[model samples]
Target: MANQTSSLRSRGMEMLIAYKNQPSVELRNRLVRLNAGLVRKIAHRVSHQCSEPYEDLEQIGYLGLIRAIERFNPVQGCAFSSFAVPYIRGEMLHFLRDRGTTVKIPRRWQDLQKEAQKCQGEMIRQLGRQPNDHEMAQALCVSVEEWREVKMANKNRMPLSLDATVCHQIDSSITLGDTLPDTYYQRMQLLEEDRQQLQRAMAQLEDKTRSAIEYVFFNGLSRKEVAERIGVSPMTVTRRIQRGIDQMVAFLQPQALQTEP
Candidate 1:
C-alpha cells in the first residue's frame, strides 16, 4: 500500500511538472483531482471553527489549491504539501473573514450568538424588559458568562470604521481614525500586551475548565457536542466554560489596568 501510494504521488508530481510547462484545462483539472484531498482536509479543519458549510470551504480551498499549483515551482526544492497547506488554509480563513464576522470570534461563540439572538425577542416579551445576561442564559440554557461572550461576539460584527466620526464638539473635532495611537509600533505593542494578558489568564484556569473553554469557544463546538466528547451533560459543559471565563475576566481586569497606557 505504501509503495503504491508513493508511486501515485510520484506520478502526480510528474503531471504537475508537465502542467506547469504546458497548461491545459484538462491537465489542470486532472491535477486538481489528483490533489483534491488536500482541499477537503483543510476544509474539515476550518469547518470546525466556522459557521460556513463544509462544501463552501471545500470549494474555496480548491481555488487556493489551484493558485498554489499554478504558483508552485517544483524546482524550488520544497515539498508540495508544505507549500499548499498555507494556501489552502488561507483561502478558507479569508472567506470566513469576508463573509462572517467570525474572524476574531471562535466559531462556538458565533453559534452561541445566534442562539442568544434567537431567544432575545421572546425573553424580552416574557420578561417585559431587556433580559440581563443571566436571564438570557437561563432562557437559552447556557451560563451567564457564555451569554456575555455571545454578546461580545455580536458586538464585533460591525466594528466601528476608523473613518467613522467620534465627536461633534462645537470647538473641537475628533474622528476615530485620528484618535488611534500615532505609531504602528505602539499599536502592535498594545495588541501583544493584551494577547499576553489573555494567555496568562487562560493559563490560570484548571485543566477541565481550560479544556471546556477551548473546545466550546476555540474549537467552535456546540454545548452538546462538547458534552459528548467529555462524557458529561451539556449543562456541565456550560457551567465549566462559564466558570473558566469568569476566572479569566477576574484575572484580566487588573492586568488590563496595569498594562493600560
Candidate 2:
C-alpha cells in the first residue's frame, strides 16, 4: 500500500510539473493554485536565514516559483524541486538585498556610540537593571534625538562576553583582561593612524577651504556659522565647501578602490 501511494504521489508531481509548463494560462494558474502551499513553505524555510520580514519574502518566492514553472524544461530531465529551490531562494535574497535601507553613518557617530555604551554600562551597574532610553540619554549628556540615533546604530551589534574562564592556564599565562587591553591598544593605535592620515589629507586643502570643511563637518556648524567664523558670505563659504568636497572625493576614490577587499 505504501509503495502504491508513493508511486501515485510521484506520478501526480510529474503531471503537475508538466501542466505548469504548459503555455495555457488556465493550466498554469491551476498548477500554481495547487502548489501555493508548497511555495509558501519554501519561502518560510529560506526566509528564516534573513532579517527581512517573512511576508515580503513569501511574495517574492511565489513570483520565482511562477517563473520557474514557466521556464521548466522536462526534456532536460532536471527535477522540478531541485531547480525551484534555488530559484525561490535567489528571488528572496534579491528582494532583501535591493529593498533594505542603506545608511551611510557619519564618522562622528562612532564617538556617540562609545559614549552611549559607557553610559549604559554605568546605569546598569547603578540601577542593577537595564536603563530606559531617557535615563541613558541623561547619563550620556546627549539630547534624546542623539541618544536615539546612537542606540539605533548599535541595536544590531551583539553583546560582549563576560566569561572569566581561562582557555589555557598551562604556563599560568596572561589574564584575559590583559590580552584584551593589548588588543584594544592595537585597535586604538590603528584608529589614531587613520585619523592622522585623514588630517594630513585635509591639510593639503587651501586654508579657507579647510576651515569651511572643519566648521561644517568636524564642528557640526551650519553654513551661516561657518561664514560668520571665516568673515565671508554664506554663499562664498558654500562654494568653497563644494570645491573642497570635490577635491576630497577625487583624492579618496583611488585610495578607497585600493583598500576594498
Candidate 3:
C-alpha cells in the first residue's frame, strides 16, 4: 500500500512538472484527472460548513483545480496538494458568497416560504391542527412542487441563530444554544464526531452504572435519589458514577489531528 501511494504521488508530480513546462489542453486534462481526488476531498470538507450540494461544490472545485494546474510552479518544491487545496476551497466559497445565500434560492421562493409559514400559523390557530403539504399549496395557490421547492430553499438558506429563543411560547425562555452542541463551521464536525463517540462509550458501560450516571447527569436527579431508585447507597452511587466516567473517558479520548486553514 505504501509503495502504491508513493508511485501515485510520483506520477502526479511528473504530470505537474510536464504541465508546468509545456501546458496543453491534453496535459491539463490528464493532470486534472490525476488530481481529481484532491478537489473532491476539499469539496467534502467544505460541504460541512455550507448548505451547497457536494456535486455542485465538486463542479466548482474543478475550475480551481484547472487553474492550479495551469499556474503550478513545480520547481518551487511546494506540494501540489497543499497548493491546490486553497484554490479549490476558495472557488467554492466565492461561489457561495457571490450569491446572497449559501444556495442560489430565487427571491420568489424566499417570499413564498415566508408566505406559507405565515399562512400555516394562521390556519393552525383557526383549525387547531397543522396543514398538510397539499393543503398549504392549495391555500397559497401554488403547486405542491412549488411549495416543496420553497421548503427546500428555506432549508438551504443561511442558518439561523442558536441563540434565538424557541418559537414555542411554553419554551420561549430557552435558546437552543443552551443545550445543543455548537454548530459553528469549524467546530460542527468535531462536535458531531464527539457526540457519536460519547454514545458508543456510554453504550459500553454496565447497565446499572449507565442508569445511575444517566439519572444524575441527564435527568438531573440527586445522587441520593439515584441511589434510592437503583437500590444502592449514596457512596456506592458515587463510586459507580466515577468508575463509569473513567471508563468512558478512556474509550472516548481523542487523538488530535493537526490541520491548516
Candidate 4:
C-alpha cells in the first residue's frame, strides 16, 4: 500500500510538471482525476461540519481542485494538496452560503453561544483546565454537534468592519476595504466573467437536470411544482438538482483554462 501510494504521488508530480510545461485538455483532465481523492477527503471533512450531502460537497470540491490546477506553480516547492485545500474548502463555503446555511441564527443558538462562553470560563476557573467538547456539551445540555453548530453559526454572524485596519507595516493607512476591487471596470469584468462561467456550467448540465434546477431556482417553483413540470418525483427532482450542481462545479473550468491566446 505504501509503495502504491508513493507511486501515485510521483506519477501526479510528473503529470503536474508535464501540464505546467504544456497545458492541454487531456493533461488538465488527468490532473483533475489524479487529485480527486484529495477532493473527497476535504469534502468528507467539510460535509461533517455542515448539513450538505457528501456527494455534492465532493463534486463542489472538484471545482476548487480544477481552479487550483489552473493556478498552481510547482516550482514554488509546495505540495499541491496543501495549495488546493483552501480553494476546495472555499468553494464548499460559497456553496453553503448560497444555499442559505448561514442565515439569521436562531434565538436559542444566540443564547447558547453566550451561555457556553460563560460556562467555559466558570469551568476553567474551577477545574484549572480547558474542557473537552463532550464535557462542554454535557454542561450545556446540548449534543456535541449542536454545540459546534451554535459556535459556527455565531462565528458566521460576526461581521468585520471594512474600515478596520488589517496591515501593520505595509502602510498602516491601508484598511480591509482597500484590498477589495474598487474600479468600476474591474467589478464589471469580474461580474461578466462569473456570469459567463455560470452560464457555461448550466449549459453543460443534462437537459432534464438543467430544467429541474431552472424551474426551482430560476422559476421559483417548489420541489413538487418542479417535479410535476419535469415529470419526476419530488425526491428524484431534488437529487437531480443536487447532481446538476455537482456537474456544474466540474464544468466550471474557466474559459482561459480551455485555451490561451
Winning candidate number (lDDT)? 4
Query: What lDDT would candidate 4 get against the real structure?
Result: 0.87
Give one digit per residue, the lDDT tens place, for model 2 in 62-163: 888788778777678776678677787788878876855455445566567766666777788899999887887787678888878876766634333445
Worst 10 residues of 3 by lDDT: 252-261
* RMSD vs true structure, all candidates: 23.6, 22.7, 19.0, 24.3
Any runs in candidate 2 off by more than 4 Å, and if so which?
A: 1-21, 101-261
For 133-226, candidate 3 gives per-residue lDDT tens digits of 8989999999999888788777867776888776455635777776685568648888887788788999999999999989999999999999
How do these models rank on lDDT, best leading? Answer: 4, 1, 3, 2
The TM-score ranking, best first, is 1, 3, 4, 2
Predictions in order: lDDT: 0.86, 0.75, 0.85, 0.87
**Candidate 3: lDDT over CA atoms?**
0.85
Cα-based TM-score, every candidate: 0.51, 0.39, 0.43, 0.40
Q: Name the regions of candidate 4 deviating beyond 4 angstroms.
A: 101-261
Model 4, range 173-228, lDDT digits (tens) per residue? Answer: 77899888779978899899888888888998889999999998998999999887
Clashes of 1: 1
lDDT-superior candidate, 1 or 4 = 4
Poorest lDDT segment (10 consecutive residues) of candidate 2: 156-165
What TM-score would candidate 4 get against the native?
Answer: 0.40
Clashing pairs in 1: 108-220
Model 1, span 123-158: residue lDDT tens: 888889998877878877888888777786677667
